[model samples]
Target: HIVAAKYNIRYIISGGNFATEGILPKCWHYNAKDITYFKYIQKTFGNKKIKNFPLFGFLQEMYHKLVKKMKIIYLLNYIPYSKNEAMEILTNELDWRYYGGKHYESKYTGFIQSYYLFNKFAIDYRRATFASQICAGAVTRTQALKELEKPPYDESKAQLEKEYIAKKLGISLDEFEKIIHSPAKWYRHYPNNEKWLSFIYDTYRRLFKKEKLGNF
Candidate 1:
């Protein structure tokens, strides 16, 4: 945002509806790519440079959270398009090909979501997305639950994807597996002003009568 402001690039448009819409739509967006890159850097550099100091890490995390909240706010106030409607316009009017699954356009993201996140963390993001869709009246809760029962990706292609992602990231299969097996960590693990920030957020929400920020 600083850079955008410096360049006078106002009115940044984003396709952030799916974060709230609850449908696990195709993840062919800048934010998806940025997340994949962040993960790659974290694994490649071991987070020393990324985290450096507790205060730095805390500030970074807070900034990220703020940006995420801003995106949702932007969607609520300015951009009023739905995932289904956007896809229709893109496919029919712009002739955009549908990319299969969330973030499938990026092989790294495909591997991470389908194999890494699923196998290691047991994080099926589709569950959240499906719930969102249910809330939005785009899909039924029963249907979402049914879909959640299945594997995130094709079992037969799992090994192939793992190999592909490992090679692409210039990491050995064993190294990649090590990362997968490692415990998950969050920004709150670092010393930070999270409580103070939360207090401020809550205060602002109460003062403005705004809805509390949703979990990403």
Candidate 2:
């Protein structure tokens, strides 16, 4: 907010693409912004203290919105969009290249999106992404299913990425493998402000009589 105020900015723009948002399975989704829960997990599971990592809880978010007037906007939600066309433009104009799958441009995102979630939770988030694309008329159900028939990522590359990530984190390959094969835990297992957040959201939604996207 201070930065925005300095620049005389009226609003903040975000890339929260509707086509790619809220498609993940609810069970696998955790509110990472819950700093209390994040700290608890870090202390319990993380090997080292991670400092200066910014996180915002429900109250902080409300402060930003209502007090700071830093209204972050997702413009994509207000209009029809074509991810294919956008990608094409980005490719031709900026010389950007596709890295096989969505959100595969970065090693961190790629590992989580393609590897960790897939191996640990046995959840194919791609299916949800494909379903979202289908709803947007970007692809047929058959096309999506055919794509899903094969592995979401190249086996060799995924293995390399896993090893690289484990090495970078100073963990042994065996430790990484053990973590993957271990039982998956949900967000409810940890302390969180999810219930409070949910209650507020539900109350507001009910008062406004707004329909959620999933309900449709």
Candidate 3:
């Protein structure tokens, strides 16, 4: 929003779609707009005081949209999107390179999706993507299952990568191990507006829009 305001941009495009993210369970992700929840986590875990963070509270959220006249445009919904074809285009046009798996656009995201999520909560991110892709006709069920049959990484290689990441974060291997093995907590355990937000969403959909996230 800050960047948009600076550049006088009014509309933003969202890549969210049924083809890639439609099957991921809501529990796997948190609302980016949940300022209270964000502050709570940062205050509880961070060492420094939060300052000038680019976020808006629930009340201020409307000011950005209604007052600033900002709008969101979801492009994939109106177009025929094929991941395979898109990847081919990217590879050919931009010289883009394919990594090991989906959402492997960066090593950090790749590690979190492939290793961290599974290690912390037993959530296989690939399963969500694969299922969504199958439903969207991006890939067949057999193909997705075959990919799932293979492990994200060899045990030895995974450990090495973990050790390297620990070093990069300036933490000892034991510390990183403890951090990873620590008890996993659900997002709802902390402060949130999920209930109110859900009510608001249902109300808005009832009064205006007919589509629902759960319907996907």
How many residue-pair clashes does candidate 2 contain?
Answer: 0
**Which one wins by lDDT: 2 or 3?**
3
Off by over 4 Å in 1: 18-81, 183-193, 203-210
Q: After superposition, how far is residue 138 of candidate 3 from its true place, in Å?
A: 1.8
Per-candidate Cα lDDT values, in order, are: 0.62, 0.77, 0.79
1-216: candidate 1 lDDT, tens digit per residue: 444444655455655664354344332112221333454546767634645422323344445445533222455435554677777899999999887787888877877777777777677778767777777777788887888888889888887888888897788999988888898754444334445555766775788687854422
RMSD for each of the candidates: 6.8, 2.8, 2.5
Residue-pair clashes per candidate: 3, 0, 0
Q: Please write out the lDDT profile of model 2 over residues 17-124, one tens digit for every residue.
A: 667564666675766557778888889988886777556666776666666777778898777878888889999999998887868787878888778988888788
TM-score of each: 0.65, 0.87, 0.86
Give model 2's TM-score versus the native structure: 0.87
lDDT of 2 at 119: 80
Best by lDDT: 3
User: Which scores better on TM-score, 2 or 3?
Assistant: 2
How far out, in Å, is residue 90 in model 2? 1.4
